[model samples]
Target chain A: MKNLFLIGLCIATASASSMLAQDFSAGSTAKSWNLYPEKKAFFKAKVVDPLCTLTGSCPDNCSSGKRQLALLRLSDNVMVLPLKNSQAAFTGAANELQPFCGKDVEVDGLLIEDPELFARNLYQLQKIRIIGDTKWTKANRWTKDWRAANPDAKGKGAWFRRDPRVKAAIAKDGYTGLGLETDEAFIKEWFE
Target chain B: MFKTSILSCATAALAAFAGPLFASENGERITITGEAIDTWCYYSGVMGGPDAVVGAAHHTCALWCSAGGIPVGLLADDGTVYMVLKIEDDDHSNGGDTQMTIASHVITADGMLYKRDGINYLVVSKIIADLGITNLNHEDYGPVPSFAIPAPKP
Candidate 1:
């Protein structure tokens, strides 16, 4: 009887692990492969361009033109979804991570699971504090200056076209502008 | 009175489990009409803010984003955003970019709607593109490259 009880406990534990959202161990390239419970979770990582982070290629500063959100990448390279604030309703807090894009930051949020959301690493971002290291400060200043220069620019492509960094890329690399590789292409190459 | 209460409770439970595979609360299949917007931009309002026009004016940009693995959303006329999930296919023929080509174009989608944590999600079963709507100039960001697009068949 005791042995049967132990077996049952083991089975329960195994099932629980399957349901819990977990990181794809070190060196693994998977991003948010499953749903997470709606609870608090903390992570420290850099906010990278989702285009470059997920697909391994992009124009200078994510000029992909899609309204893609910034994604958080842990030190070990685990990707996390940074939630977005909506425009129609104009919530003051939606897409709060925009300013911190491409910078290292600490994030704590309720892990709300929604598979449809990119990265499947949904977090109801309770707090974000920038790391403010040398690398972060430089990138943060550039982003601020870029925004100041193009106050009316809203889309990635628009900003990309107007960006001096992107112009340098274009002058250096021509119309290809840092070469494009998208997530759809990655999935097709690997999974499909 | 006790018997009536038991019957009502039983019926409610039955309705929930016996409903269609992805039925909304009403146990009905729903069809929503709206502009297909990239989920990231709709929520973040990052590019052009939240009120940015998402139809033909932004079609190319939207397509580029949607094809890049960003989740596509159906921003309904009623101001509701339904995060769309593609029903998986074995051959992977109906990829995301195919859908984004119609970005910024108005279309009707038939699907089962689900509301979770105040967010709307739809398991889109069929998409009916309204080419007449696509042909019309709704708003403008700039010149949409004259890439030839075939109209949806009548």
Candidate 2:
């Protein structure tokens, strides 16, 4: 009887620890699906930078920050914005996607019903693997032309300073709606 | 052996039910004032009206749109949009209706804010309806409201 009791206690302790660990671990259902009824599924799609996909205009500096890439469903023109999980756990999915911009990849994640500004689906990326490649333009391809034609806004939302959408947004909201209003000193505290 | 089997089963059960408890890492406690809007319509720019923030004017449509899995958003006065998860708890299974009932109405809610993957979610603890006349656009658009933007002053 004593042996059995010990075993039961051991089991209870083990289960409790695992339950606690599972809650904090990456891909925790609680973290991904507790609020929204997100469904997990596998998807194969080509990754494209939002600006290039939307405006057919790729900026010269196609850094990760400037180029937010999302998956474009092949069958439908649906966009999937991948969300990052723990850096140590799920890895930085955004960084993983950067290299594969314009390449086809397979992603497994929880599909949120939430849509972006244009009804694009929001996908919480869990696992991603490149399936194939597509036409990838070299970075800074338009640097010379874009610079020559436009006045420099000096890295203050520089990528989109001249965009018509940005101009219209400024006209309506008084600001670019980007981080242009953020102080350079404040930005340095975090960056430098 | 029997004890080991029981332990395994208990552990499995605990893991299965432990999801909600760990889902959100509640950030700072905050009080935010905003209008509840259907994320789909607001983001898609097809709000079918001038304001995407649904109130009685767009309540019925908000209900239908949100019922289909679209997230409900709280567009705050500061221009910050928070994705509101549950009202208080998960008790109200018919969340679509509950959300639509408060659509476009200005609300001041106290909650724990959470940030996951660059997105901000507000795990609302308490919500207070601010039913001031200006706080609401009470023009109930009926069960199936038509989208009309009273033609721009042409």
Top candidate, metric DockQ: 2
Per-residue lDDT of model 2, residues B1-154, tens digit only = 7766676667655664454333344467889988776554454333344353455445434543343224567877655677665567532212234554455557888987765333556667788765411332423332123421111232
Q: Tens digit of lDDT per residue, candidate 1, span B38-146?
A: 5555543335434543654344445544433345677776777765544222111112344544455566878767543234556566776554224223223321232
Error of 1 at B60 (Å): 2.2
Candidate 2 chain B superposition, TM-score: 0.61
Interface RMSD, candidate 2?
A: 18.3
**Candidate 1 TM-score to native:** 0.37
**Candidate 1 vs. truth: CA RMSD?**
17.2
Clashing pairs in 2: A30-B23, A31-B23, A117-B43, B54-B104
Top candidate by lDDT: 2
Candidate 2's TM-score: 0.36
RMSD of each: 17.2, 18.0
**How do the candidates score on chain B by TM-score?**
0.61, 0.61
**Scoring only chain A, what TM-score does candidate 2 earn?**
0.43
Across residues A27-130, which tens digit of lDDT does each residue of candidate 1 receive? 32222312233445556767665434333444454342222444445643544544432111212122355466677786654455444332245444545667
| Model 2 chain B: ten consecutive residues of lowest lDDT | B142-151
